[model samples]
Target chain A: MFGGYNRRYKHFSPTLGCSMNFHIYFPPSPPSSPSPKFPVLYWLSGLTCTDENFIVKSGAQRAASKEGIALIAPDTSPRGLNVEGEAESWDFGVGAGFYLNATQEKWKNWRMYDYIVKELPNLLAENFPQLDTARHLYLSVSAFAPIGNPVNCPWGQKAFTNYLGGNKADWEEYDATCLVAKFHDVSATILIDQGEDDKFLHNQLLPDKFSEACKKHGVPVLVRLQPGYDHSFFFIATFIDDHILHHAQALNL
Target chain B: MFGGYNRRYKHFSPTLGCSMNFHIYFPPSPPSSPSPKFPVLYWLSGLTCTDENFIVKSGAQRAASKEGIALIAPDTSPRGLNVEGEAESWDFGVGAGFYLNATQEKWKNWRMYDYIVKELPNLLAENFPQLDTARHLYLSVSAFAPIGNPVNCPWGQKAFTNYLGGNKADWEEYDATCLVAKFHDVSATILIDQGEDDKFLHNQLLPDKFSEACKKHGVPVLVRLQPGYDHSFFFIATFIDDHILHHAQALNL
Candidate 1:
């Protein structure tokens, strides 16, 4: 068993209020160790979660200790200060960051894309010597629940249209498919595991779209679709060993 | 992030008293998902640690969530009343189980080996369906301090001694010169990464003894001694990615 400390910092999010907090877990490091030399794994949690969700919930420390990997889990969305009508539903508002830089009127100030992909990684790399920014991987558990084609479900179109601001083009940047294509230069391999029965993300739309986008950009993606599974951590936890192994394999360590 | 409720159980130890806690992290299961199964990575923390040490220190949730693997971390040693005098120093006392069952008088009740290798695994398998026991792997970091000739460290000696304890009166187990012969029947591969400058385990002892043991048993051991490294998690974290990759390659995942 090992114990370490987490230093918290406040980052300004135009979309969320001024009280947003991000955490960085630094493995206990000896002072004499080299600086700016550790690799990092950036984790994107699902909707209705803060950065603390994964940190508190996922049982990943053993593997991290064994593999010596550092994890960075960011809040799903911005928080603080009530945006009118933000609390209406569980899908959106405070918890749903959607990994996008919102462009719509009310959410124009919200920019999860930059915060997640750029700011968070930058902050972690700048602060921790044990983190290797050059070699980082991105992970998310079913972030696209209400956006894509619902397939055989009715809620799909409604959620997609509402969250996307009634335009398919608006979904592009926030869409992992589009994000992967835009950031094709990313060195880390993309890993997406989704349950077949996820109510928000129709199995067909997510894995297929993400795969298509990855393939188009020469990104190597290992997509595992568990049949009859739903959106839950059990599915994620069941396969975490493989994910660590995947990153480990990619790093060849 | 995934969280599960873990219940506490007590086991009696003549030497360590009644202070052992076992907890299992269960990933959330989606309503529609089939029974999810995950591979288990059992973690053994270093000295002065409880079951919670690695769980809190290592930033492994992101990878674990991504890979869906179950991580099980156990306490370093037994605690509580009556086990007082288990050792005269920090290296031998309440915090240092050493993953070995004690044979000496005042410490005879310290059966850490049984607790770690037998009881812990059994409890996990019985309680968590996501964990696959067949794919279990054992890992130790700075497990033993320098005990043998500086030229022939204690890691190998401890491992060999433990192996012998499990198979007493077997000369075949004493043969440490044949790698393949040593690991012939053990299902799990042995992976040990020690820092050359580790204050605890001498560099030469672990590697040499491990190599000799594996050679005698016809088992191949992967021992990596990082140059100028010390007995800190930083050294382990530096090469954690490699360890994951090794497991991936071994599992052919």
Candidate 2:
């Protein structure tokens, strides 16, 4: 291969009981920038997404390869461990974790929140020596969807009600709108691109809530409402490189 | 969106007897060369591949968008049908049509050759008016795997044997190695990328056969054996742009 391998790995996740699949793309070290270590970006896809979806569809690898930034894309939710009717609904049980920790009994083990933030990074850092150990690694504003689940409906309500119980306050930790006010990563600029014509905007996503949350908290957030764009990877594939550049800048590239 | 769109369409195929899905990407027309009509390249994926595989994983859109070459990716085989034992094996049935016309009584109707070379182009012309009607509208050298059944084995043997009957002569038409000597397209150069370390090479694919055939026929061919790369989109994503440029040159872009 011209660059290093875009590898797929399946490892035991202590957080999520089931074996999770994560795709990692390590940029080929160019001669000019001969640093052995690369800054890693954690990509958390939206509802009805998998690890392969972003890396596969987004056209991000070309820029990631060029910028010398390694990309780590985790599966949206845990699989294998049958968490009650997980396969029944497209949005509720599996494939729509919403990257949240379940407070309820049955799915309390659906710990994608911990997996993405903690376990995966630790695993990556330990396994791939090419990543800079000292640098901070976590997903921040570089996502295509609106942060908070829009008013807890569609997959969001199904996930929250099932995972976090009827108490809506418990959803705040996972909700982007609520989390932004409390997020401590002050330097990481919030970068969101919402398609104005996105089909799911009515019930599934609302960018204004997250935007307003950022504004209210006096945090830097740039929400670009792209006209004629949609919720499909068509949107992500359209602007993935810009998001990568935003990440590259954060990495001091 | 940076480019026009990675559009999806579902249409009835008279050949496959099923609703076929084809993904077409119309590259954004540049202001420098404003033309409503754009040349296109048809991408036929390897075994166990779908219409989304190349466009989703290969990172071809950015270069295609820049080159002003639209890409049409069709599913590997006819789907949405209750073909006998179609889902039983990965290579034999659903995902592994081998892109050949089935001559056997059971699968004579599996006319991927007709669909790809004829019905698809006509459909494209009828649906997308911006396409240049006079130009070629089918796949040639820009496929993920080697063509021409490679001495008749792997899924190729099963497909050819089942689809084209037991006659080896019947397979020659779809076989690139055999057809190179007979193909009349002397003006179009052949571009093939074979990863040297591809796992399928041992069992299924043989690029040397195709390469040797091209040389003997005096046809212009570039067979790049990418070292250490395997039979995956990783290889395609790495060298997709160069492949597009090759197609653009042929399209006289």
Candidate 3:
């Protein structure tokens, strides 16, 4: 939207040993600049979402265009792997990668952590020269309805058990609440907008626990509990402008 | 989106002889006014669209909320009619109503013109006291990728043949280009934004014919050919703010 191009790309991910699809919203280049390089904002969508959900539903491109930030949305999980029981549940295998590298042998294809952190950036730098991925202002915004404390929730517990075997230590490696304690040197403040009426707020998305963990680590985090909102993309579209402006302010735009 | 509530309502229409579902985006009421009534904007979606498409994909609520205009979206056609070949083609039957009344016996259920122009207004007035449908300022913004001269296009020719029989005279009543010559006393200027790169621009969406007809009838019409755009919700989302603003100005918001 807003004079931006939502370009799709498919690249081989060695981290997951499969082809992955990703979408990037490249804001219209400035008239003055011959080849404009934009700071990137990586949007990690929630469960049951592909790369297209953020591009189509978020309505963030309007602000992203004004702020001169490119948006990158990688697919939630590896597809066409043909792993047993992979396509069974909507919240488990296919669209629910949880952005973690799986430790178990059966679910080795779920290496979204490495895919997002390493391969995707390298791919953007190599292929899309107009994207400024090397800048420190490049920010990543995870889901508002995320599995914040994944080690405690049923959706996370089931996914962790299947993807990382029965090791609790392996599960903590992927949990945001657990990781916040270990790595507390975040540059920008974390902004999370949670819908008050989200059905998964109590069980699946434990943002309260994540907020508590962030407080314990002195990590500046702002968790907004929006009233009368749900976990749907409508909620995202409602607050996406504020999120984009927040990122723009952090990036000193 | 944006603070507005997208509420769905189902009411039995006497015109179509079926229960039809429609959505209304009620802009959050002004703080000073306890019970508010706002001017309405009727958004008629293109082919293969339901009431939900404009609510979900158009991102119009953001502009509607800002402009204090409530949006009403009706379904494209009378669904679940179970006609002999109603469910066969995507372009002809199910989702392609063309917003016209049918004269043929087999397609007698297709009375979208009366449903939109007559029944829906009565339903809104009876049920929704918060909507200002009685006002002359209420505006209707039809599709940007509409079958403007439907009598000449393949999609419209097939649908008209099926819905209204083989009479060429019946098709002229439904075609916008043909109807524009007859109804030239429009209060506000007609604004149509057509995508230059739209695949169906040359064949289906003949805005040129409509513009010519409006000119011949001395109707104030502005047809903008947006470059590098296509016939998708993305194109609509880009220009929806402008449309909303135009309606708001006409309503004296």
Candidate 4:
């Protein structure tokens, strides 16, 4: 929207075994830089959200356009799988992939973790020549009302039981709170904005727990509790510029 | 979203003969202003839009918050009237009031002209004490793909036929292009931004016709033809900052 071209592309995903669509916002090439390619910022949306939510609502493109960064928004989950009772629940199947690789055979198509972490990057590097893959930054691991410590929440319990089976160890593998302690070699400071007025603040989202884990692991993190804000795109839109600027500085733009 | 309170209110409207809903974006009150009331910018949306479209999509709140301007977005047309076949067409019926008073007996409830022009302001001044009614400015009369000379366009013709009893004379009363020549005492320069790539640019919009009429009437106008843009909220979000700044200057903010 802000002097950027937002393009959508559909590609068959080998990981998810279903066709996926992603939206990319390419800012106008910087005339000052010798390199033609722009840095990347990938937005991972939360529950019940597709690739279009961030592209349409976040208002992050204004700052991304100003900083000469490209934004890639991947679909939250595989669609049209027609798995039995997949479309029934808002929290478990379909849009609620939780960005985790499924351990269960029935929910094997819910491999968003591999799709986002491995396949999507390879696809971007191979196909999108205008993107500078080296200078990439993943912002907002999960947008509004993020499951900070998913393994400790009911949402995680329900989705994990269905997708990952009864394995506690497997659930911890996908949990960022647990991963922060295991892989504490993270160089950059993780920035998080949690809305105090969010309905899921105490129940689904436990940002303080993640912050404590990060502190114990010696990983630098900033979790700002925004007052009078809710778990809506409105809250995201308000602070999107600051988040984009944070990424820009981390990318040394 | 942008450090502003977006509040939605519903009140009975005598003009429309139905309950009406309108959204208002109140910027944080300027500490410097002697009077607490803020200058307002009224946004009249086009077809298939309600009070929420601009509130959710345009991202104008950021600019309005910066400019210390309150934004008021009224419903496009009266709702829940239950007139036979009122909900039939997407363009002519429910969402498309054309901001004109209806002359036809069946569509007598569609008095958006009186509602917006006379009743809304009074309602705001009486109910919303925080708004300065005197320093008000109406921006984007018919947001995206505006029917400039509505009397000539097919959309306008159909809408006028049903709402105004197939009379061309009644159509001229609400047509901006037609009214410009009759009441050209506008002191400030009118600014318009039309997407060049909009599908309805030449057919339904007809911006040049409005510009020509404004020229003939000696009313100052600036029509910007935005390239590679289309009839979407993306196009609005791109140039909303410029439009807000223009209004701020005109209001001497």
DockQ of each: 0.03, 0.47, 0.76, 0.76
| TM-score, every prediction | 0.46, 0.86, 0.97, 0.95
Which run of 10 residues does model 1 chain A get worst, by summed lDDT? A140-149
User: TM-score of chain A, model 3?
Assistant: 0.96
Kindly report the docking quality category of candidate 3: medium
Candidate achieving higher lDDT, 2 or 3: 3
Best by DockQ: 3
Q: Model 2: what is its DockQ?
A: 0.47
How would you encode candidate 4's per-residue C-alpha lDDT over B1-253 as one tens digit per residue?
A: 6666899999999999899999999997666864677888899888989999999988999999999989999999999999999889899779999888888899999999899999999999888888888654453332345689988889889999999986688889888899998988877788888899999998898999999999999988889888889999999999988888888887788
The local lDDT score (0 to 100) that residue B57 gets in candidate 2 is: 75
Residue lDDT tens for model 4, A1-253 = 6777899999999999999999999997766765578888888888889999889988888999999989999998999989998989889898999888998999989999999999999999999888988644463233345698989999999999899999899999888899988988776678888888899999989998899999998988888888888998989999988888887787778
- Name the lDDT value of residue B169 in candidate 1: 31
Error of 2 at B7 (Å): 3.5
Candidate 1 at residue A29, lDDT? 51
Query: Against the correct fold, how does model 3 do in TM-score?
Result: 0.97
* Candidate 4, superposed: residue stretches over 4 Å from native: A32-35, A134-144, B31-35, B134-144
